[model samples]
Target chain A: MTMPDSSASLPAAASASAPSTKLHAVAPTALPPGVRDLRLDFFRGLALLCIFIDHIPGNRIADYTIRVVGLSDASELFIFISGYAAGLVYMSAVAREGFLFSSLRVWRRVWQLYVAHLFLFVIFTAEVAWTSMKFDNPMYVEEMNIASFLSEPHIAILEALLLKFKPVYMDILPLYIVLLVFFPFALWLIRQSRLLALGLSIALYATARIYHLNLPAYPEDAEWYFNPLAWQLLFVIGAILGASTRTFANSGMDFPVPRNRWLLGAAIAYALFGFGMQFLWEHDLISRVFPHGSEAFIFPTDKTNLSGWRLSNLLALAYITAYFLRADSPMLRWRVFHPLIMCGQHSLNIFCLGVFLSFAGLIVLVEFSDSLAYQLLVNGTGIAIMIGAAALLAWYRAKERMPRKPAEGPAGGANVKSTALGGGSAE
Target chain B: MTIFHFSRRGSLGWRTAVMTVLLMAAFSPGADAAEATPPQDLAQFCAVPETVLPNGFLKHARDAYRAGKPLRIVAFGTSSSAGTGAASRADAYPARLQADLQERFTLPAEVINKSVGGQSARQMTSRLEDDVVSLEPSLVIWQTGTVDSVGNLQLEDFGRALSQGIEMLEKEGIDVILMNMQYSRRVELLVNYSPYVDMMNAVATQSGAALFDRIEMMRHWASSGRLDFDNMPRAERASRAAKLHECIALQLADMIEKAVRR
Candidate 1:
């Protein structure tokens, strides 16, 4: 694994949330500090849940469920949110800690992300390799070992070290880590002023479009489901939103309208759009344009460029979600919501686990599904294992009573708390 | 006197210029007369000599066996015509037909394979000027209708292209011979296309072009157990069917020999 060898201090931002766990620790308040934004938590949980169903492997129930709920590809939404969230975190860092310190913090996270990435590679690779060897499928065997594992020694080393690969909905971690590298710069521009950041982001976006820049795929098999350069716009937009929470707070994320009317309108409009796009794609209009769901066209599932139609649909969903977040609903206060919140709060951990479970589950289920009853049993067992793993992590975190510690600063750790308070005050 | 002389000279020049203009107008094309006479059958324009055979088959057959000149033949159609499934271009039935024709007639024949891949009769008809009519071919063996049937083009459109194609070739004085498409189970159901093949044959009958029934010939071979259906490789079954196809092609070549001999 190619990992960058760099260690740097990062100042803490945001006072740690109350970490009391005297009870069964069932409350959202029990989670470690530095992670706020309850709405983001809800979405993170929702995205993870959708990913669970999408990767359940040949289960009619999961497929039907995902298709019905429009969670078949919650990855795009999650990635866009990731860009948004990175902006939220790093922009605040740059505002309080100065450019150099914030840049170091971004680098540190990228390192952590790369570390997390190697673990993902091993998990997914082993699952695929094991499954292929057991089932005796030549394609899978070649794909898991010779093609993916050993195709490009140099590039793989570079990816491991720099944490770079083509950004795709599937391989989002590399995309996220790569985008994080630019966040400090993005945030610095935002601090210099929003107009400057906005201008640069647009310029970069246009440049990406004109040049048609894209990440290189694996040399041997050349599979790409995402184009990072095209997707960077979404990330930058997210960063911009994340940086200026005051706007969202003041206007309640642009929801100051009569809540019920806007929610109803958004719901109906989004439904119509989604259904219309799905119909066109099914009947084969968009495919005629690009023929293979390429990101260049303005159509459904063009997640990379975030086609206007998809973006508008997403905005509509965001509005509907914002309404729900503000309004009273059982989903907001349910005991079940707490576990989701825990999973959502510690998303990096949750994502890592979800990736492992899904990869393992898919391989095992695909093999077992030949037998009807065995298929159902396998799916049931898979779901149970996922829940069990989430429980295990929650239990482990509770036992440790771990708090998110601010990085050791060059001047000292005192600078970290001041940075956090300063950011909090600004918002 | 001077004025009279200059007037006389001007009159002479004017008269001479008027006479020249009148002569040019009589020979030259009128402005209203359209110059772009849309491509009339250019094959007839290249009037090549035909070998005249003697009265009886016995005499002409003997001459054919002894003919020293190479026979010129042209074949046209879609992918199958292009010999897509043939193990090699050499194995393509057209090449095989040319070899057979050369051997039997004792003639050094050059076969021009003008087959293009994935072309419907519509496309072929559109390009007839360039591919067939331009060659002024002694024998134009047309193999079409495979794409016509499969591509679901209107039967009327197919008929129009076929009629125009035959008419254009016949106008060029090219001895046109059409080899109808081979049989496929898929096409037997489509009445529109299957009947269009017959329409093509009727056009040939009307236009006096020799009609080769390759479809019927293949059926005969299939019934006679000459077509190796069971023993052939699954992928090669289609190619093996070309044996029957080649027989039809060779039979057409014989007809062309007879026509050219005449």
Candidate 2:
């Protein structure tokens, strides 16, 4: 480990205001650790919330999500930020402990994800089946694509263990598991040359896209919903950005951005175009003008294959965000985002909980009322529960981190505003 | 889309015989003579082109109906076919269709609804043998794609299941009429039904099945003021659904008549 005591990334987000920064590999740790860029937690947290909303059927909250303003949805940001966090943490691990130990840690996390996926599958299936039976609606099993599981539990369980029998919202966790398997090698490549690593990742994505290559699923010829082969590009792009500091400045700490007006203008223009196009895609107002569906081509934006439109849209938006909302922006540290940051810090737990809550929310909406006021109430209550759970988990973890029981420790609410990034973990 | 003729014309082999009965059946009192008055009169709902070309693929069903045998049909779909929103099961499109067909013909007609609410095309495909084909129905009116679109399921999966189901029915010499999602302008922004609709059309075209295009047909109703769906109150859904199902039955019966011979 090059800097075992120091983080591979910035020591704290405090250096986000510096003019130039070196990779943690070069920087000496002179300050306290556990600080991460608030943006990662903020955006990742927002993406998690969007994912919860999107998972539920007939969730109108989804209309106001990333789909409204960009071709890329929250799924992209979730994967990219996951890679970003992995790179920020594990790249340093590899440098410090060599590939073998770092890979062991990665595998441990992957095992956790695999277990989490199966656990979710069990809960999601049971809930759907119970709801359907309780309501005397057999189609609920079909809706979640768990009919096979219900019909042939033995075969379906094996297939699910192989990560082939993913019902609707269970695809992302499996993809994450697959991504972590190759992280050791990918991180090694990134350490040698970020461009070469990213270039190889893009090449694989291109080949996958061109050939329509993806892993097949169980009991059906259809491939994985979020094709990992193509999706690795986004993760790699984020990983390289996370692993490498800004190269333009060498004197002082710098945020991971290369500011240029032309690039900024182009990014802004593309993002605006995507926003307008997405608006049209959702409303389908453009079809009305043409009357006979003349020249009204349905955009071939394939989510499964991670179409180029979505990729470019995500990259453009990321750039615009980085250029305008600097790492040290006051909004990043806003008190309003505390709960979100807490949610982000304990993302894995919050994500699993959120997935379950979404289904519960759906059941409530179905069993009760789905009117406007009711929907708002359901959404508000669901999000509040997620936040509250996140805060409690964050508080518990903070207590576990301390060696002694502090006599003057603040309560959970007070600690929320000052909650350190990455869950206050120095590791 | 071959126009059925009520007037006598120089007859071709099958055309001469088909011309005598189908045309009269097509013009059956329908919306124009419907007992309801003013807004309730379903004249505007029946304004669509009645001959949907489902008959081009209805060779076996047409022959059965022509032989004076009891014509049987299975209404397979989700909530809409299962009679959701309507006042009662009889008020659903399938039950109303049986009555509509009986009124149009002297022969015994049965329309069995094997619809399970909230099911997708995938589920319908699985139930093809047990619920629909086992009944030995000559025709299957499959209402699908709504739940799939609403739940954001895979388009390819939906298309594949739909095509497979249609192929199975076609292999059994069953006429298939593919009905799409119900239209609600309010959720239009929330759900992308276009891809599923397009996929349905593609599958129907490929399999030689007829597409009812319920989504567009209802959209047409909304735009033309034939129905007021967007501003409809919760309490009004029951009555409106009854009328909606009745209008659908009327239009479908009209289409069925245009394709079959007496």
Specify the highest-TM-score model's number: 2
Q: What lDDT would each prediction earn against the true structure? A: 0.51, 0.69
- The DockQ for candidate 1, computed on C-alphas, is 0.01
Candidate 1 local lDDT, B1-262, one digit each (tens):
1111234465456435533522323332221211222133422221112221111122222343356545566788665656665555566667877876777665577678888865667788877888877865555678887655443344445666877887777677555667776542112211123344545644554455656666655433433334423223355555454554465455655565665566
lDDT of 1 by residue, A186-220 (tens): 77776666556665666676676576555655432
Each candidate structure's TM-score, on Cα atoms with residue i matched to residue i, is 0.49, 0.66
Worst 10 residues of 1 chain B by lDDT: B47-56
lDDT of 2 at A55: 71
The DockQ figures for the candidates are 0.01, 0.04
Give the number of the best model, judged by DockQ: 2
Residue A372, candidate 1: alpha-carbon lDDT: 38
